[model samples]
Target: MSPAVDVQHIAKAFGQFQAVREATFEVRFGEIFALLGPNGAGKSTTIRMILDIIRPDSGTIRVFGRPLDDAAKNQIGYLPEERGLYKSQKVLDMMTYLGTLKGLKPAESRKRAMSYLERLELADFAKKKVSDLSKGMQQKVQFAVTVMHEPRLLIIDEPFSGLDPVNRMVVKEWLYELRQKGSAIVMSTHQMNQVEEMADRLLMISRGQQRLYGEVQAIREQYAIHAIIVEGQGDWSRLDGVTQVESLNEQRRGAVRLHLRPEVSYDDVLAAIARDDSLTIERFERAVPSLDDIFIQVAEEDAQEVRWLNRREAEREVEKEAV
Candidate 1:
């Protein structure tokens, strides 16, 4: 089957600067895909193009095997980086109104909106004016409006922003529930830990280009460092392939992070430790770099691309002056 959403070689430019360049990827059904990048990485611009809020200068976007259009719009739900709602309107009324725009009738919208509000613990605040609610409360209402119509695809940009830890957990759980119901979701967020927690796959872009896009585990494996922590009295420094080792604790009771020579074998290292009768193995495990580490690695890789481009531009300018 075709993917839930697919964009092939999409490019968007503004004047002399390209905001997105040859970006290509797809979101599989029933998986949470994350778009991760720093500010000005064209994440929002790319999302807008996907939603047809802004047409791409070049390339195609297909939703459910059909080209993007009005009918396809109803198949996708979008929660933008910026929140939009009528401040003076009653909470339930505003939510229902927005839902109605997505093809839900007023009665059906109200029923769905109220059900969500009550589940979100905002039923008592249903009649209250949106302006009277706190920022967090309004955010929850916005979330309600976005999902009430039950689109097959959800595009959420920074869904965890401005949410407290408790509320963040609530929203995270709700997102998983949506996925459990077979909705494909693409979430854009800077919170690496949260992305690692929820995303099944990741598409990282930097400076208008794709840096890394693949299964999260695969991406992590690609950047794995050959290092491990050994928690014992063993003098890891004497082991073959041991590049360096520092006492992890002043009391000599903590694990050490060993930097290994690329050619060293795990068996050789273990053999060395085994010879140390005084050493008692408390824990021995390979070091697995976290998502944050992977993010930094990929971002740096993209930054180098940007630097190379800048150098070529500078050289062209110098050649022009010589001419």
Candidate 2:
């Protein structure tokens, strides 16, 4: 089957500012992909291009193997980060209108809207004006409208923002169920832990530059530094082949992380500990870096490099002027 969404070297700019620089990626059916970036990193601009809210300066975006058009729009759902609804309108009425705009018949729209309202536990507030609902309830109503038409591809920004833990779990589980049913989902959020939990794959951008992209676990393994997590009751810091030791258990008995030196194999560490015969070792496992760690590290490194480049250019200009 063709991919759910294909973005090929798409780029956008605002006058002198390049908003997106050759951003490219794909989302497959039955998968949840995370689009991660810091503020103004072009994630929003990229989404706008995909939705045709704004045209890309270069490259293309295809939805479900076809160029984005009315037909494609009908098969896509978008929950924008700037959550909006007609505050004065009744929840059911607003949803019904939006669903019909997506091409659903009026009767079907109301049916779908009401069904989603009931499923989302907002049935009691169906007739209430959106302004009467709390911020979280309004968000739920917006989500209901976004999905009432049953779009094949879903794009949501900051899906967990403003949601309490209970509601967050509710929405998270619903997205998982949708993906299981073959929906291609793209979520852009700053919640690394949430991404770690649900994202099958991820693409991270920094200042409109691609920093990382891959399966979540595989990306973590790439930056894992070949370390081993162990639980033992001896001087693991001084253990052979263990160049660096970090206490995972707060220096309590037996829980620590050992970083293997370049020339030392993980097997060497295990063998040396075994040969000691006095250490009470319990657990030995490979360590994986967390997404949060990788995100911060990559973004900072990118920023530092950009700063260094700017400084070098400024120095060159100064020297040329003197000459």
Candidate 3:
């Protein structure tokens, strides 16, 4: 089967400023695709283009194996970063109305909205006006409105923009449930921790260009440190083949991060540590870089590229004027 949504060679510009550059990615059924980038890096612009809210300078966007149309749109749910719930309208009523607007039958919309509110632990707030709900509750209510019709594809911007960790997890579980039910989910967020925990595939954009895109685990492995994190007794600094070691913590249970040289395989490091009877190996595991770390690395790399391009352009201007 074709991907739920396919975006190819998408480029968008505002006046002379290019907001997105040749972005290409696919969101498949039953997977959470994380669209990540710093602000103004074109993440939102690309999303808007995909939804047909704005026209792109060049590209093609396909939903359900064909160009997006009214019927195709009905199969997709979009929740923008800036929500617009009717404050004076009762929570359930507002959601049902929006669902109906999305082509869901009013009666079915009401039933599904109630089910979602109850699932999200907001059933008691159904009759309450949207203004009466807390910010997090309102967020969940908006989410309910988005998914009430059970769209086969979901596009969420800043899924957890607000709310404490406890409430964030509540919404996280609901997203997973949607994926389990065979929906393709694409979420854009600055919160790498949530992306690391929930996303299956990740696409990172920098300066409106594609930085990295692949399975989350593969990306982590590709950028993994040739090191191990160990929590042990006695000094690890003296271990042979260990190139560098950084102490992460030493209070409750001593933890140290180890970096290895090219010649030092993880097995070699472990064997050498084992040879030393004075050391007790508590926890020895490979260190995987977090999504936050990868994000910073990619962004810095792209920034350098941008700087180089600017310098080249300046040189060309000087050469042209000199001639």
Q: Evaluated with TM-score, which candidate comes out highest?
A: 2
For model 3 the local lDDT of residue 146 reads 85
Candidate 2, pairs of clashing residues: 232-254
The runs of at least 3 residues in candidate 3 whose Cα sits more than 4 Å from the true structure, single-residue gaps closed, are: 233-235, 247-255, 311-323
Listed in order, each prediction's TM-score against the native is 0.90, 0.93, 0.91
Q: Predictions ranked by TM-score, top down? A: 2, 3, 1
How would you encode candidate 2's per-residue C-alpha lDDT over 89-114 as one tens digit per residue?
99989899999999999999999888
Per-residue lDDT of 294 in model 2? 93
Which ten contiguous residues of candidate 1 have the minimum total lDDT? 246-255
Tens digits of per-residue lDDT for model 3, 1-323: 99998999999989999899878889999999999999999999988988999988998999899988999999889999998889999998998999898998999989988898998889999999999998888888888788888889999999888767887887788889999999999999999988898999999998899888999999999999889999879888899877788888547468888888877899988898889999998788999988988999988888898899999999999999999
Q: Of the pair 1 and 3, which is ahead by lDDT? A: 3
Relative to the true structure, candidate 2 reaches a TM of: 0.93
RMSD of 2: 2.2
Model 2 residue 24 lDDT? 79
lDDT of 1 by residue, 4-90 (tens): 899999999998999998799999889999998889999999999989889899999998887887877877889999987899999
